[model samples]
Target: MLDKLPVVGRFLGGRVADDAGWRRMEALLRKCERRPVYRAWIGDVVVCDATLARRALLDSDNCLAREPSVWQFGDKQRVPAATVTELNRWLHGAAARHDVDAAARIAVVALAAASGDLHRAALLAALDSVADMLGFDCNPELAAAVRVYIGDVFHAKLVNAPLDDAQIARAQGLASRVAALLTTCDADLPAVLRNDGVLTGAARGEVYLHAVLSVVGASAVMLAWLACVLHMDTVAGVDTSADSRAQVFTCKPEHVALELLRLWPPASAHGRRVLKDHQVGPVKALRDDDLVIPVFVLHRHRDTWPDACAFAPQRWHEDPRPAAFMPFSAGPGACIGSQFEIRWLAAVVRQAATLGSLQLVQVGRSPCANTMFSPPRCRLETP
Candidate 1:
């Protein structure tokens, strides 16, 4: 079935993996580690060699450019360069940690207030709070609308299913309304977007729309991963007191979050459009085609990681950071918000842990999307 799809299909075409994709990826790793470079299709190559994958990712001369894997999944609104720069600037700035934690606190309280489990209502309710922190005029109802469009886009892409006309129209209308709201926000509300660069009229609206959606969507995906990790573990929860809030995350939650990244990186694989022909270790990648590094496969490489298939949080205690760690990718394009995301997710878990240890009811692999977005399905109950 994979062989029937295009080169990119290797990552996108399969039906949801039966076991969070670990079993399928492990089988592929066993086969791929035998060969440094295996052309999955004509021009698309799945680079399995860890050393070479790292080099290809760090290719500083812009030899390997980040390709739009998400766009291929039917998200028509593109994220502009200015929008990315602004969001990056804010997330990496001095106030970033404080701001993210503020947003997380809001989400936690909202999630806890909601009835039922950590389902879609609870997740979007959490995300809308983050949107509000970003200065959006978002309310619970508006947030629900925003989530509907986004959920459709992501779900369609993951399932490799087509969204009907009504679905697309509904999504676009919600997007436009959100864009209009962003356009009217305090002119200096996003000083980073305004002063640091010049984005005007339609461009400004588009950038703001993309940025807001990205923050909400990205946060939801990461939270989903956090849930997945919790489902797999028995991390004891504890209350954050006056003395504990500052230090609570320094302990178990960090290990739990890091292990999550290793096993279910938000983006299972990364794609680069080659700028020039070059040799990485032994593979010579030609230009004008996509070169993919399957992190899903590489992270489980038999020769690289002992007990590659096993989930081991203790490994982080042994080495706080692994050498070939690329859950956030490596080199220049590595996720600029890596530290921010890690701290934020850990804080979320640390807070939730006080309620009870995570009991994974189920781990649902989303219809095969570009990334490993298997949102962990669980019900929070005292164990």
Candidate 2:
């Protein structure tokens, strides 16, 4: 019965971690313009082809694609189907009746807290609570991770472990700065993010997580300051001409946000398990085989993007290929937080544009590729 299963169907069952195997798969993707489908194996499962992979991803019915669980990590265990269904129903209902953006923010925060990045999780949660009037649902897993991520950041332990002295001090400093910024911004633009209605229970939880992310972001800014000092000269010529130099310094924070995302994507890659025997152009995949989709590689593919390696904000002024860019993956498994992120980026950029020249002062090494959000570490000094 297993042998008869589609190649793609088998990918659903096991873990796949083969470097060379993926290279071979990429070769197939490269040559697949002419053929509609092909076949391959992820372990014992036979995937039909790349076309099928794309189709499966695009099709909502055959595959079960839903918002990632707030507490789950990795492929080790599947979220109980019933729990996922219940969560989805609640989320959808909340989105329809209440503030969707607030809910989404909470979801991301909850997920981050579960990810073991405590500092970020706690800060985001606190910010959300204060700014959006929302609270986070305190799952045990989330609570434990939050403690680990924000040890010593807050006086009261929201998580199981206590943050050390250094972390606590850092957290306090960040919270103060973020609160000040939010106050200034709120006072300046009351109409943009108005708090009109009472937040639902879930909304409250979401706000808490947002606070955590904001605080974490402040720390990241300090780190970015250090990187800027070291690489100042390297990026100097990139902004040539007096006009461009002026523009660079005056560029809105949104532009900076975009540059940050392109430079350091949050999630390194997205994975999928083939559901049936299918083909993607020329490559063949077996049923249940796992397919590792590298968004970084696709984003920087020279053929797909002109000057793929360079960081040029102006490039966005032109039309970009949809397939080549998957900072938020395409099709069914795409990120639900995309809209919130875009809105936040725009707000940040708009604020920066109005302020004086924002100079980056790098303080530490760039963040390693882990966690869900890929923010740089630096400080901004206006002159």
Write down the TM-score of every candidate. Answer: 0.74, 0.49
Q: In candidate 1, residue 283 scores what lDDT?
A: 64
The per-prediction tally of clashing pairs is 2, 97
List the candidate 2 regions with Cα displacement exceeding 4 Å.
1-56, 59-77, 80-259, 353-367, 372-383
lDDT of 2 by residue, 1-383 (tens): 00121122123211121222233334443543333333333352222233343454565555433334231322333345564454344333332343434433453343233322323332443334223221122233344433433433431232112345877555444433433333223222221112322322323223333334433333232222213322354331133234433433455544544554554344434556667665554455556665544454455455555765555556565554344455555575555444444444444334332322334443323222223322223344433
Candidate 1 clash total?
A: 2
Top-lDDT candidate index: 1
lDDT of 1: 0.54
lDDT, candidate 1, 139-173, per-residue tens? 45445545665455544544344556887676656
Q: lDDT, candidate 1, residue 373?
A: 38
